[model samples]
Target: MTDLLRLDHVTKLFPVGGFFSRRSMKAVDDVNFALSADKPEIFAIVGESGSGKSTLAKMMLGNEVPSSGQLSFDGTDVAAIRGRAAREAFMAKVQPVFQNPFEAFNPLTKLDEYLFATAHRFLGASNRGAREAAADAALQRVGLSLSEVRGRYSHELSGGQLQRIAVARALIPNPKLIVADEPVSMVDASLRMSIVNLFRELRDELKVSIIYITHDLATAYYISDRVIIMQKGKVIESGDARTVLEHPTQPYSIALKGAVLPPDPAAASAIIRQRQVVAG
Candidate 1:
């Protein structure tokens, strides 16, 4: 099977400091990975702030260009994608879901407007009825419908609802891959799992591949098929999600695992000791 996406020795650098004393800061360094075109699964990128996960996502989305190396989607070079038509074609296959659902849309606009716009833009829904039907179908995939959100503004819905709408909008394009960056961090604790489960549904039912980027190990462990741990812009450890997180080999990864507090008080001490053993 052909690869859906491939990043080969990819790096992104930004010039810092004044012109006379400029230096390149490597925000992403020689990152490499691939997703299979024939198989759809959720791949997690685990890291803390400044770990280059977001930069890597940006590069994959064509929002930023890599300084060196190659990024290809479905065997086509990302850098070679140019012009509005090409960019749209690329985006039709790859969509993004951002953190902070409240900020994702304009507060004054009707919530369904985004859904309708996405349907009309990508799915080629030429008429109002077709656009509405398309939006409704996409929303249904996320456990929402247009009638529930037709005239509502962003502020009218809860964070989780807005995020679901965002996911639904992404689905309107019928994208093969969705790059979700910290998608559940801002949602209510009680509702976070629902959104996470929705991603799993997308993968299992819709056959969509997801690039699940997050700092939360618990959620990553729950939903990811494969995982990559990053620190300071480089991949430190990667493997089957359960295997890597259950027995992290790197000090950085072990520290990250240690930071996740066990839900049961009775298990906390044992987990801490296990983490200590692994860290040492």
Candidate 2:
């Protein structure tokens, strides 16, 4: 079988300097990777701020186009997908869960409205009963029920609940791939694991391939099957998540791993003291 998604020598450039200036900066530089349609796994794109991870997510979601190379999904070129019908068809197969759940929905809108609308649009759940059933099923997959969110507003729920709703909304389409960018970054510390663990369930049970974009190496270690570490818009390392993160050879990769604080108090304290000594 062909790959579900393929980015072959993909590159994106942005014009820099003044309006008259011709210089350009590469946001994504010749990145190549593929996800198998036969297997579903959590593929992590790890990087710090301005590392072009978000830019890559945008390109995968069709929100932005690459300046060079090709992006294909399920054997068709993403850049060539034009027109309202084609776009909607593409959206049904690929969905996106954005970074901030607070900004993803409107405070005035009822939560179920979003889910119901998704069902109606993508699932062809034209009747109220059909839409409600479709929405309820998707909500259940994320550990939510229709009664829990039917009339609630964004402000009425915790960040974790709202983010789960966002994931549930993405699921209503039964997408082949989900591109989630910094999903748990805005949630509370107590609830971060809930969202991270939910992604694992999404892959294992639903067989949905996910491109998880995050700066949190700890959570990436906990959930990802494979990881690609990016720096200055380039992939410096790629391999099995455990192998690359636990025994990274590159200086930058090692530094990133060292940045994670150990769970044990004494070990963490010693690491902090070592850093303090280095600074002195």
TM-score of 1: 0.95
The sequence of per-residue lDDT tens digits that candidate 2 reaches over residues 85-112 is: 8999899989999899999999889989
Candidate 1, 110-214: lDDT as tens digits: 988888888888988999999999999999899998899999999988999999999999999889999999999999998999999999999999999999999
Q: Against the true structure, candidate 1 has what lDDT?
A: 0.93
Residue 39, candidate 2: C-alpha displacement in angstroms = 0.4
Poorest 10 consecutive residues by lDDT, candidate 1: 266-275
Pick the lDDT winner.
2
Clashing residue pairs in candidate 1 are none
